[model samples]
Target: MADLSDATLDELREALAAELPAQAAFDGWKPAAVDAAADALGVDRDVARLAFPGGAVDMIDAWFAQVDREMEARLPAEQLSNLKIRDRITRLLETRLDILAPDREALRRALAILAMPQNAPRAVKLGWRSADLMWRMAGDTATDFNHYTKRVTLSLVYSSTIMAFLDDESDDFADTRAFLARRIDNVMQFEKVKAKWRGAGGERPSLTRFIGRLRYPAI
Candidate 1:
């Protein structure tokens, strides 16, 4: 794996992707499967280690990166140009889930792996990455603290929607879409409240209390 110190990150990723499907057919994202996948790629099995130093956790991250790339390709600029920001976000997210539909079982396994306590940091990082991708692809240009805040907020929304999606039985994931809409609506309302507070006087205790009550509330 480390033997090819000159190998580019893309090269390692390609090798992993080539080997991943077969391995994923077995144990989702386990190291044993990752190694087998690496071996199947006709490279040094240890190359899997080099490809993903964090083992299965890293593989999960790569998987999501791949999904994001694919989503961007599938969601063309012209298709998004005329939509409202909220609708753009909805379309992009829905497209992502559509792409993942064929691999639902694999996603379930990946989620379970990520749910382990030891992987919490990786899980958070993955969530951030997905949210960031969605915002960028949705045409976000914010560069200030709003950038981080947007990602964090959307991370929560996306996480909850995905959890709902895992068991979604409604036709075409209608339940998941409904859940996502409610979450988005909640955030939009919160944002409206914050904007009014900022415009009104900056730091009203009542506004703060109201905002506090809105976090993660049941829809």
Candidate 2:
């Protein structure tokens, strides 16, 4: 909580984003939640409202962005470099779940807002952004079809895991952890099969290689 006397709206948004969720858990992402967060952060309520012009979605978006920032802060590149790719991805996702666990009620309400037909596109964008960040943080450098596929697959996995987590009552969320592990295992198996097929020179054409060739014709 720094001095907001000279802070811009975006800075105020970021400063208050982490605090809003706890209030949202009680106020359900309304003006009162913003007011509560503003009071807690010593930010003026009027200025805080200016920071989130898009209303609930804006608040949810800022909070989700804060989660991304926290995720990177918790797991820096050097810390992940020595691990296997699967382990890195698993750790990154698990870390996010842990960061979000305390604000599950707020997250549920946010998801409800994002699920509306009017908000579907924004929801998709947010999901992709998070998935992309996770992949980058896990050290993925693929620029081919793998890039798109990995993010799409991970978005699905992460969303499903969140759904499972919302209702999971097992000890330490073991059920959700098991569900995530199974999804990751399935993805790893798929990658292994794809690699084996490529190595064995199967007749199937490579879409990524074809796209690459289209981009840079034989020189």
Candidate 3:
């Protein structure tokens, strides 16, 4: 709503990102959507087109970036610090679903476009970026192989959850929430087993000790 008459293209892109999805919901992520968003924001149509030279994907990307920023604002560090890692991830994913709830149709259209062969690579990158941001926000500082593994695992979880969310008709998206919780539980259990396998000081654990530890882990 602020005066964007003098704003740079990048600034205009960011400012218009949040507005695009609503227009896209009705207009299907086309040039008309962009033009409507530009008009709504009092931005020049030509300048807005310049801002999204990559077309639909660019508009979708900018909208997702806005969603990420909103997620961070809704769940800042102080809010997540006191929670366990599993809880932090669940909360973050849930927050994103809430943010995208109003624009479900827009999201469906965007996902369809991203699923196309031409956009598959960009889609993967966007998924990874969101996962990485969630991990960073959750206070994860892993720099080893865990860094890559965590993001990959989370990307799968998030993408699957989004698919579930798209068709979820349960009140409050209860089904999607349940699906995400199960996915996170699977990842957490896998991490626990991997940690136990590594053992203290990275020494290999005896089979008996490993089995016993799995059966009765120390509190």
Better of 1 and 3 by lDDT: 3
Q: Compose the digit string of candidate 1's lDDT tens values, residues 116-201.
A: 99998889989888899889888899897568767877877777778888899999999899888887886677667667766896
Ranking by lDDT: 3, 2, 1
- Consecutive 10-residue window with the lowest summed lDDT within model 1: 204-213
Candidate 3 ranges with C-alpha deviation above 4 Å? 200-219
Clashing residue pair totals per candidate (backbone < 3 A): 0, 0, 0
Per-residue lDDT tens digits for candidate 2, residues 110-138, read 99999999999999999999999999998
**Model 2 global lDDT (CA atoms, 0 to 1):** 0.87
**lDDT for model 3:** 0.88
TM-score of each: 0.81, 0.89, 0.90
Deviation from native of the Cα of residue 27 in model 1, angstroms: 1.6
Give the alpha carbon lDDT tens digit for every residue of 1-219 in model 3: 699999999999999898999999999989999999999999899889999999999999999999999999999899999999999999999999999999999999999999999999999999999999999999999997678778877887788788889999999999899888877876787678669765655644344443343333332
**lDDT per model vs. reference:** 0.76, 0.87, 0.88
